[model samples]
Target: MSDNQNLLAGQRRALILDEVRRRGGVRVSELTRMLRVSDMTVRRDLDALARQGMLEKVHGGAVPVPEGRTHEPGFEAKSALETSAKYAIARAAAGFAAPGGAVALSGGTTTYAVAQQLVEVAELTVVTNSVRVADVFHTAPRPAEGGPARPATVVLTGGVRTPSDALVGPVADAAIAALHFDVLFLGVHGLSEGAGLSTPNLAEAETNRHFIRSARRVVLVADHTKWGVTGLSSFAALEQVDVLVTDSGLEPEARRVLAERVPELIIADAEEE
Candidate 1:
């Protein structure tokens, strides 16, 4: 490559890494616009980073490498949706967890809420791939203040980080495969009868699959808004989910479908709580 070409390539790679760290991931279209480069140039840059293992390239974007734990969505953005519903779901989910049970909490807003509820529970072991979820347990107070002793153990999966600050990909999958959990609670970007549970990233989907396989039971936690929407990747089929926990706002037809498809469907009315 010529001097100018080499410089441009380096600049593009740097910008890609920066965007992944800032946003957790960056779509090719966004990178092309930000770098003022063609689609092909952006793809080339992503490929280079993938080769170096700086990031994991997916269908439309790239995920950050696991290193600094600071990468994740801002509190405001993540806390914007289904706040009440998430809490209710968290409450219901926590009820199913025994005092010393091992649980895998996947990354997502709803799962984050579940982690918060777990603060009051004693002797629970939580394995997660979310930086934000891990922080919840790490900062929880001791039982003297009427809280549980945080949690017995918190395991963070290592891998590429998504814009949502989720750790995913091969490293995360490997970690999940090595352990078995009594229950696994997952949060999805979308839920559909035809599409099942879905996420916006392929690497995350793979990581979720491993989580499902490693768990004795899989519980899906999603607000009503997730129903009917289709994301970029399909993680698990509805049949694979042992329980479906959703908000009361879900339509009657949706409830019927979930009841028929999954073994158990729990709807929590946030307004009632």
Candidate 2:
């Protein structure tokens, strides 16, 4: 390419990186419109930036690299990403929730999806650290006056709230220590073979460990995008996971590897729901 073309590409990539830094992430479609370029151009820009390690390319978008090991995006920042995949994973994870059984749910956008799915389960006692997840059940419609009032009982742990809307720290850990669950639907910031399940928040990581210990079965609910991403703090290893419920977006090789690590792996079809 000529110097002029090279200059233009460099400028475009700078703008793309700026947008990602500003918004935490940007979709190719959005960038195309913002940059007044074709989708192909936007994708190429993303590919180039990803190669430079300036931003991480997700399924259809690019997110700024986490600053060191402690940087974390807020709930709203992450809520818009991987929506269909999250719902699909939620559907699969919710199947593990038995009727009238106790379940623990950790905080994250994906676990919030799982919480939405669990609202209809009868007589469920859901213990959760996510304010958002607890709201899913709290705001659910009540049964008719004459009908049996069998709404899921939600216990929101009290603690300092994190960027992802998770109640963490000492209070949250103490509450979880007294409770045990039949299953725990845990959501993580990142997962990998080396670091296992991890999060940028140190306190949240400690609280998640408590959740893991209190549950008879640990069901990890994460999308394909979390693969190979390691956070600041590691909570559980892949081998400790009783089951993994992820979306079909996971690559076949990853599926094979995860199947070997975890006892059960459930891949939900994102397009189906």
Candidate 3:
């Protein structure tokens, strides 16, 4: 390839990955317009990346590979969602956790909220795969009359890093497998009748499955918006999850579906209080 062609290819490849990260998936038609490249050229670029296992090609677009890693979302965009609901869900989920209990928190914004609420609780050991989640407790202050400090031990899993800052892979899986937690709080991209618990990245799904296997109970913490969207990988079936904690704004139909599928559903109304 000529120097200009090489530069173009590099740029296009970067754009493709960025788009996939941003949208969770992207179609060929969208890329062609965004990158101003011929459909054939875009296909070639996607093919090259797909061969490397960075992405999975679908009919018209590509989805991220399920690995411990993920595409990053803008901080502002992620923070804009049902904030009140997330806080309520966090409080309710945190109530289920006991002091001195061993817990594993999966990566995601909802899980991050859970970590924040956990700071007030004393003598808890938290194992997590999210760099962001670990950081929250790492800087938390100790309680004034504490027998032991608040937010006891925080363990961060080691593995390959994804764009979304998740640590996922064989290393992560092995680490999770070695410990049995009292509860595991998982964050998901989407929940559907057919897909069950799903995420955009296949690698993340694999690592999540390992977490589920290692935990005695599994609680899925997600917002109402995640109810209908379908991602690329299914991490757990509804029956496998012990509890589904979500906001009160959840659609009635979605609640009915979840109640039918999941064993228990906890609806936290942040607005009530």
Candidate with best TM-score? 2
**Candidate 3 lDDT over residue span 1-273, tens digit each:** 223244456556865776786689999998877776689998998898787666799999899776442444432335435666778899888887888899999988788899999887778999999998899999776566835668778899999876456789999999998999999989888788888888777888999999999999999999897887777888888888899999987999999988998888999998786
What is candidate 1's TM-score against the reference?
0.71
List the pairs of residues colliding in candidate 1.
Answer: 24-163
- lDDT value for candidate 2? 0.87
- In model 1, the runs with Cα more than 4 Å from the true position are 1-76, 145-149
**Model 3: CA > 4 A from native:** 1-76, 145-148
Model 3 residue 208 lDDT?
96
Residue-wise C-alpha lDDT for candidate 2, range 1-273, written one tens digit per residue: 223233477667766776787699988988777777789988987887777567899999999886667878778656656777888899888889888899999999999999888877889999999999988888888888876555457899999999889999999999999999999999999999889999999999999999999999999999898998889999999999999999887988889889899999999998986
- Which lDDT value does model 1 have at 172? 93
Candidate 3, lDDT over the whole model: 0.82
Per-residue alpha-carbon lDDT of model 1 for 1-273, expressed as tens digits? Answer: 223344446555765676786588889998766766679988887887777656889889889766322233333344544567889988888777778889999988899998898877779999999998998998887667654455789999999878787899899999999999999989888889999988768898899999999999998899897898777788899999998889898999999999999999999999999
Summed backbone clashes in each candidate are: 1, 0, 7
**Once model 2 is optimally superposed onto the true structure by TM-score, how far is the C-alpha of residue 100 displaced, in angstroms?**
0.9
Residue 187 of model 1 has an lDDT of 87
* Candidate 2 worst ten-residue window by lDDT: 1-10
Q: Output the lDDT of residue 247, model 2.
A: 86
